[model samples]
Target: MDRPSYGYSAADAPPPQGPTGGPSEQPVCPRHPDRVSYVRCKRCDRPACPDCQRPTDVGVLCVDCERELARQQASTRPRTAMGGRMGRGAPVVTYTLIALNVLVFVGQTLAPQIVEQLGIFAPFRALAMPWTFLTAGFLHGGVLHLALNMYALWIMGQYLERTLGPARYAALFLVSVLGGHTAVYVIADPMGYSWLTGTVGASGGVFGLFAAAFIVGRRMGGQVAQIGVLIALNLLITFTVPNISWQGHLGGLVLGAALTAGMYALRPKASPGADRQALARRSALVHGALVVAAVLLCAVLVAVKTLLVLGG
Candidate 1:
């Protein structure tokens, strides 16, 4: 007996005719077309199998729709207070700096001449290899020296990188290195033994990070008493320990603190009716200007010291 088409259950119903007048197959999942799916995505209304279905507030969404939604949400997400991304990804700049320092240390161990070639020497010699002022920050004197600086960098970098972003943080470290080397050049007596000695270590950059961390921590209302103690102990060691460059440590600390304080002070403040994008642009410009000013200050100091030493 022929049953009415309306009376047939979906599973038992005759397959629809194709354009060529052949029996058409049932609807299948787009991702896995071999499997037939009775369920369809609520959002896109596309056939989605159990594996491709993701539960949402209203109904199941296909994987593609869910991924698209996530992308959209991430695009509109807010940035950090200091204009850095909110994502908690690995600190690439910090790790790279550490790795570079380690590799340089390995080179130093393999070739004893690396220290002489890369380390900062007398002001007159530095004019020939000006890069030494920055490169010296990546060269370590000993295993203990490398370990301590790397540890301090790792501790402070993880926080500062996330707060200030990579470019700003890199500028801070590099400028502080310049500041440290410049201090050493300006303070060293041409006739003294220290003037001819080559200085190597990441202490200058690490000290800069320490100072920045202390300032940022205090500004963000975090407990900074530990940072204070750390700085004080290191300063004490810088003076008491032989071969330690007190000038470099003091120079880096002072520069880092001043730069960070100025950056924070000049940062854009939020207001009820303020334009966020405009505020972000203003913040970036101010921060960039501050970093440039710091670099210029370091250059000026080096120049003045060179003139004084040459004139003497």
Candidate 2:
């Protein structure tokens, strides 16, 4: 039985109205006075006024409508068993750091002295610049150097960041950088170039991250022994290899270990209490002290260098 539909036409349309009962009434948002509601959410048949509109590339869904949909779908989701562990996927920070290192390495190779003058060329004394301490970790001498360090960084960073939140992870990284630079400033002389020293690559910070991860793993009573073996092997390499920043690596390791201990001391363990928070605060204070002490050490070393230069 074909018949004419009784849909409301434009002539019969009500004036625009907000979600609140207002003078306007054309499916307008309650919050917005001038906006007319024209969109409908597909998931839940809610009329979306301009303020309520949620736009997608293909369609739109209002916030309330999405909640309604999520409520429906949530019932279908099954609970998984316990003992779930984090995946060893690429940690965002680790990947970005590695990419930066690779890019700098390429620049060093292509531009030759350009990288050296900038002090981004790693392991090469004449090519390194004072600024290279920060930039060098982002540069590598060769394929093996780049690959090994980047791989270590990825593996260690993934493990550490998963355990520590992004904020603490960031702090740990910064501390490592400072530690590495301090080591370089203490041990490596600029030779003839006093304004800048030879520095390149992030082995120090990477080593520090590894050390922290190792300590944290042990504290959590997880993969302690495995990490020990890795650390030992790498340490052996520093002694065996030529022209590597052994001092920087060792410095970072020490700092990382200390920070990891600090983090563990701060954790709530099984109990969530004010006591735990207090302990965490105290732990942070200790860490801050260590950083200050390290800075002082760097200052002393710099002073000694000045005296030596004047005497020579």
Candidate 3:
């Protein structure tokens, strides 16, 4: 027995006790003091019950910490180069254009002279008033006209603006406006009509957006059949409706599809570790060229129409 004697160690000692010489009290949830919990918030290290806890990367966080983290993330969201909100957030460009159209309509109501000054007329009587080609897209003939155009704009503008970003969206709209007016100017007098025949509305731009949505949606693997049906229905209406500008709608649709196709063609193909900035620059240059080409084509068409009118 004397040969196997063991020495006393720390493990052999009695466990330490609290101030009252008893076992320590179990931790309880701050929110529910009666319920004992071992879980603690990763942020504040506060004891929290399962009901008050939110799982995170590191560990569970209390409800307050989770909400605060969410707020911080939302505040730091990225924006586009043009200082507009990025991604599929609110369509600021769409809303701004709508507001501008409404304001211009109100102004038109106040001063009837604005229609003559801003509306697009055939035969190019006032070539000096070239701004009318663009401005006419913002004008509305009447309340019903405005309501219909704005409704279409609201639906299509939101989709296109979200898909194409603000700068490209704005360019598409302006080009569509020009395209519509150009079409009217070129073919409006094939049978010798008056040069005073004028047109005004955002329908051209709206139709352009519709065309863009269809093209972009198809490219991105969306419901193509539905879009096609919608486009066909609209075309039917354009052709059947009395006083509707089929030329403008067709012109806008063609231009929109062409512009979007050009953009797709010019877009840099996906490759291993492609440089986004370089791709964006190249795309911008291509867009600028396309816009210039469209403008030149429009000018040529206007010049041709003017010569024809003068000759007649």
**What TM-score, over all chains together, does every model reach?**
0.74, 0.59, 0.70
Instruction: Please tell me which predicted candidate would have the highest TM-score against the true structure.
Output: 1
Q: Give the TM-score of candidate 1.
A: 0.74
Clashes of each: 0, 16, 0
Error (Å) of candidate 3 at residue 206 is 1.1
Q: Which stretches of candidate 1 lie over 4 Å from their true place?
A: 1-76
Q: Specify the highest-lDDT model's number.
A: 1
In the range 1-312, model 2's lDDT, one tens digit per residue, is 532222312333345655586655456443453666667555444456766777776588776655655655543332111111223455676677778878888787899587756755332332234455456566666888888888888888776666664446656776776567666665655463423545556788888888887776776678678788888988999879887778778877887777667556544332443343344445446555555665566556656755675576
Q: In candidate 3, what are the lDDT values of residues 1-312, reduced to their tens digit? A: 222212322233234345676654565666665566788777766667899889877989777678777766654555333222365668888889999899889988898785546665554454878888888888888999999888888888887776677888888888988888888787786555435577888887877888888888888778878778878998999999888888888888888778877776666553565544455666677777887888788899889888887797
Q: What are the per-residue Cα lDDT tens digits for candidate 1 across 126-222?
A: 8788888888898887899899999999998888888887878888888788778888887888878877878878788888899999988888899
Error of 2 at 82 (Å): 22
Residue 81 Cα positional deviation in candidate 1, in Å, after optimal superposition: 3.0
What are the runs in model 3 whose C-alpha is more than 4 Å off? 1-88
lDDT of 3 at 144: 92
